[model samples]
Target: MRDCGRTRWWKGAVTIADIKSSIGELYAIEQLARGASAVHRLHPMAKLIATAFYIIAVASYGRYDAGGLMVYAFYPAVMMAVSETPCRFLLRRFLPALPFVLLAGISNVLFDTQTAFFIGPVGVSFGVLSLAVILIKAWLSVTVVLILAATTPMQDLACQLARLRIPAVLVMLVAMTYRYMGILSDEAHAMFTAYTLRAPKQKGIAMAHMGSFTGQLLLRSIGRAERVYAAMKCRGFHGAQRLAPARRAAAADWVFCVCVCLFSVLFRVVNFSYLLGRILV
Candidate 1:
């Protein structure tokens, strides 16, 4: 019985450590943005517009056009390479969002049963093709967004939003909401540490205590937010907070944006997958 208790405690400690590590990794994108690579050096507005345009183009593909969607992967592949972003790291972030995408894809698999193609003996349904397209679109969209986030600071992105005439209140809310995530995580970590210290023998928090624990966490977070807002007010925050001056787009930035928009249109109109097959045949 004593040995069993010790084993449980050990597992609990390891779980807590993993949680702490994940919390740290949450801010890894911010750290990656600080890199001095060419992609990282691009103006935030340029990257933002390019990313949005790329995603829009990707999402505009037909349900069974998986082959054409393959070409869209080029954007993320090249951006990841240029930005020097690690595939495995972005993949880890992507995995969490996979289940939701899978749920949507799987529904198509169950319903749309018309045959779209056949390979030798096997008939592939339109649903299967649609599923593949969904998966591909999800990968491309998530990867490009991750790449943009990794290369450009959130503060810069928010400032660009302001320049784009997003309402000042909306801009401030978005920026503060992002910053608030760090605060919430920090509070959760501190609370977990304190709980573990207080309940050294317990393997986990008791279910009966969960309500009180969560209530306390909420109270603590609210208090922290209040103090933060007070400090902001003292510092002359006027409804909206601008982290940095909006960067004017350089000639290179305009060139980059134009090229991205042009390539997006090119990829949309030209089915490179079919062209590749023709050449191969």
Candidate 2:
């Protein structure tokens, strides 16, 4: 049992390839945003505004009202299909965010036992109900943001943020941080690979070395940032991001944004599923 456990742990350990692959995934999504398809062609501001409203609607639901959350899944499902995004890829990207959500949810399962409903003869409690709500909310929220990213170029999105009257420094911070993720990720990957090559059979960095290992990574990342900034300056990069030339939002863009926001607000107010079930029976 002990040997099997060790093997599983080793197998599950993250590698350089995994880290690089994540960077590749982000690059792929950014490329996807450049496509000429309908969803991609929508104004960045429209998509951004719609996404904000959708998130607000999703987050407004009560913890025990998981059924209403099911209806909200329509947005992500349709967005994935219409946007031509691979569901598996987005889900893989979401794995990191899932754990904390699950951790919070699982506590409700163990602690809150008040009866909430029944699945045929099986009784369900508020705990289980809340867990389902939390999971659905996380999935919906993440998917909405992913869809926004998949459809809107990062610079354009940043531009819309600026147009919305967000502070220039804050927008620059968001843009710069996002711009540096790929670089930092590559640095970390290289350090991890070099560490592994020297001690091939070690499961991971030793606890004793964790501080030094992370400090080295931080130092390299900072140096890389300095070099990047110098290159930017050489190219005449100002403190501002050069947004794409703004164009008038066509009528269709306004219609699309309004419809989506209206529908989201409608769903938040009405339990359409329950009403339909009642009328039919």
Candidate 3:
């Protein structure tokens, strides 16, 4: 019984470590992408506009229309390739969100069971087709978000959000959270490392001690937030977070937007599955 308890404790610790490591890696990648020269030339608001439009189109499409969703994949693929972001990086970032989408899709499969059409030897049921549509929508939406984040600096993105009538408080929270998340993550990692160094073989810390540890972390974070607020006040920060002067969109920005809008509309309106059926006959 004691051995089983010890194994479980270590398993929990390992899982925590894996989660932290993944977060740290993602943060590092974002920082690197933000510093890339190409990203500096792109207007942050343009990226924001493209992402917003992509998401809106995806949401407006019918849930059983897999053909529409598949056509939209080209948008992200083209953007990803042109931005020089590695396919591996985007896949790694996007895959973490897929399981939740799949789980939600399972319910759609169980509930909507009307037959839609036949493809090859397979009879496409409404349930399965709907599930596939949901998955594709989720995937494309996530890709758009990732591309936006990769291309735009966090501060710039926050500014764009603020301009777009997102609540000031929510924007501030997002901006501040992104700024301080790295610090908090580092602190958490140090604490975990110290704990492991001292108690590697111990089954687990006592419940009372665990509570105390959490309290300490919260107290430290509160203190840090206070200090940061004081620093901001000293720097002449008003109620609004003033950003650097905004830049006008370049010709490339207009061209990019027009192309994306055109392709997205064309794909959504043309039912590829129906076209394929006609071609086959």
TM-scores of all models?
0.89, 0.88, 0.87
Encode model 3's per-residue lDDT on 197-253: one tens digit a residue: 797765445444677767777888999999998998999977777656677889898
Model 2 regions lying over 4 Å from their true place: 1-11, 232-242
What's every prediction's RMSD, in angstroms?
Answer: 3.3, 2.7, 2.8
Clashes of 2: 0
Candidate 1 has an lDDT of 0.86
Best by TM-score: 1
| lDDT digits (tens) for residues 1-281 of candidate 1 | 97677657666554534655675776888899999998999999999999999999999999988888888888889889999999999999998889999999998889999989899999999998899899999999999999999999888988998988999989888788777877777777777779979888666565567789789978998898899889999999877765678767899987998899899999899998899999999
What TM-score number comes out for model 3? 0.87
Better of 1 and 2 by TM-score: 1
lDDT winner between 1 and 3, please give it. 1
Residue pairs whose backbone atoms clash in candidate 1: none
Tens-place lDDT digits, model 2, residues 241-267: 666667779999999899999999899
lDDT (C-alpha) at residue 149 in model 3:
79
